[model samples]
Target: MKRRLLLVSNSTLHGGGYLQHFASNLTRRILFVPYALHDRDAYSKTARDKFKTLGYEVDSVHETPDPVDAVRKAEGIFIGGGNTFRLLKSLYDSKLVTEIRKRVLEDGIPYMGSSAGTNVSTISINTTNDMPIVYPPTFAAIGLVPFNINPHYLDADPNSKHMGETREQRIVQYHEEPDTPCVLGLREGSMLLVEGSKATLLGSTKARLFQRGKHTTEYEPGSDLSFLLTDAQ
Candidate 1:
C-alpha cells in the first residue's frame, strides 16, 4: 500500500483559526496523538473541538487503553504540535512507533501532522527546533518520509539585531554530518501532501530544501516534491 500523508508546518496560521488552512483535507474520524504537550487532556480537547468544526470526530490516543490498537482501528491519524522530544518519547514509551508506521505505510491510513508532529514523521527528530525537555531511546522516528523536516522554518531577518544561528545555518550544520538526510524547511502556512510516490507542496508559502553538498533551493506552492520521497540519506 502507498502512504498517504499531510505534513503541515504549523497548525494555526498567523491570522487563521486552528487547522483552518487544511480543514478540507482532513479525514472524517481522526485518531489524535496529543503526546507532545504536558497536558494531554487539554491538548486532546483542543484538537477535538477544532476538528469538530471541520466535521471530523477526534479520539485521542491518550484516552485509549491500547494506543497501538487505536492506530490499527483508526480511519486516520492526526498528531498535534508541541515539544518534539516529548512527543517522540511518549511514542517510544507507548511503543506506538512501529504500529503507526505499519498503519500508515501498509494499511494506508491517512496521516496528518503539524509542527512537532511533522518533525517526528520524518527519518529522525534531529532537525527539530524544540529543546530536549526529555529524551527518547533514540533519535530515530517513524520514518514515514525518507528525509528530515524543520517545520515553522524561518528566514534570516537582515534587519534583526539579535545575532544567532539562522534556521538555514543550523540545517547546514546538520548536513556536515556524514550520511545525514536531506532537510526540508517547511515555512509556516505551508504543507506537503504526499500520495504514494508523489509529494506536492501546498499552501501559500514556498518551502526551502537543504541537501548535503548542494545549494539550498526554494520550491513554490503546488511544486512537485516527489523527488524527496526517494532521495533518502
Candidate 2:
C-alpha cells in the first residue's frame, strides 16, 4: 500500500495555495471534513469553496447520516484547521475517528490535515488551548502518528499579565503527562509529511521538538524529519 499523510498548519486552500498545489497532481476526488467549525452553514460553505478552488468535488458530511461512506470513497481526505477540541468532539460523537484511522492506516489513502487536523494525529488532544474555549468531549485521538502537534507556535510573552497561563506554559503543563508524546511546534506554513513510517519536515523556518519535560533542539526547515520520530524509540 502507498501509505502517506500530509500534516500542515492552518491555511486557506486557494487555487495556487500550498495545499492546492500539493494535492493538485495527486488526486481529483478530495473529501474534506470540516467538523471544527461550530456554525454549520459557515463550515459547509468554507468546505465547498476551498475544495472547489482546489478543483475537487467537495462534499460536506455534517448534514449526512453516513459520513463514513464519504470517507471510504475518497481518494484523499483533507481535514481543515479550526478549533482542535471541536474537531475531535465531532469525530468522537460520530465515531468518524475510528473510520479515519482505518482509512489511513489500513487502506493507505493519503490523509492531509492542517491545524486541528494535525492535532488529531496524536493519542490525545488535551494539549490544545482550544479545549478551554470550547467544551468538547475529550477522547483519545486516531494515533495515526505518535507526535502531538502545537501549531502556530509563538515565543513566550513577558508582558503585563492577563492572569491565566500562556500557550507556552500550557504546553509545559502538558509535558507532565506520564508518557509524553513528542511535540512538533509548527509555524503557519510548516508541515510534516509521512510516507511509510518516516515523516519529513517540509517548509520554511525551524520546527521545535519537545520531549521528556524539556525543550529539545530546533530542526531546520526543509529537512527529512524521520529522525525526530525514529530517534524517540
Candidate 3:
C-alpha cells in the first residue's frame, strides 16, 4: 500500500469542531499521540470523543506500555496538536520514534497529524512557531515530508506597532543553514494530503512556500504540490 498522510495546520478552524476537516475521511482504529499537550489524558479523551462521534475508535499511545507494538498493530495514527518539542521528546523517551517512522514510511500505513504533530512529521521541527518549552535531543523529525512545516503561519500585521521579526523573516533565518529544505507556511484551515509520492494541498486557505533567495509563493487550495515530495534535502 502507498504511504498515506494528512498533515493539518490545526485541528479546528474558526467555526469548526475538533477534527471537523477530516470527519469524512477517518476510518476505524487509530493510534493517538497526546504527549504534546500538558494534560495527556484530557487531550486524548477530547480526541476520543470527537472521533468516536464519527464511529472511529481512538487509542492514546500514552496508555500503552508497548507503544511500538501499538503502532505496528494500529490501522492508522492520529497525532494531536501541541508543543512540538514536547511531542518529539515523548516519542524519543518512549523509544517509539523509530517504530512510528517504520510503520508510517517503510510499512506504508495511513498517518495524520495537526500542528505540532505536523511539525514532527516533516524533516525537522526547526520551523515550528512554538517556543522551546522543553528540550528534545535534536530538532530532527520523521522526515515524512521533505520540508519543514510552519503551522499557524501568520503574515505581518501592518497595523501593529510592535516591531519584531516577521514569520517570513524567522523562516528565512531557519534556512540560513546551507542544507535546509523549503518551509511550508500553513495557514489555519490548510492541510497537505500525501499518498505515496503524490501530495496535494487542501482547504480554502492559501499556503506560503518559503525558499532560499527566491520570493515566497502562495499556492491556491487544491493545488498539486507533489513536486515537494521530490525536493532535494
Q: lDDT per residue, candidate 2, 1-233, as tens digits? A: 35588888654442136566566667877777878777866876877776776577766667566888877777788777778877888888887888889988898887888778888876777655465465666657887876688877666678847788766677777787687777777766778878876777877767777776565668887777776555364
lDDT of each: 0.87, 0.73, 0.83
lDDT of 1 by residue, 93-207 (tens): 9999999999899988888898989999999999999999997999999999999999999999999988889888899989999999889999988889898999999888999
* Model 1 lDDT on a 0 to 1 scale: 0.87
List TM-score per model, in order: 0.93, 0.87, 0.93
The candidates, ranked best first by lDDT, are: 1, 3, 2
- Choose the strongest candidate by TM-score: 1
TM-score of 2: 0.87
Q: Which number leads on lDDT?
A: 1
Better of 2 and 3 by TM-score: 3
Clashing residue pairs in candidate 2 (N, C-alpha, C atoms within 3 angstroms)? none
- Rank the candidate models, highest TM-score first: 1, 3, 2
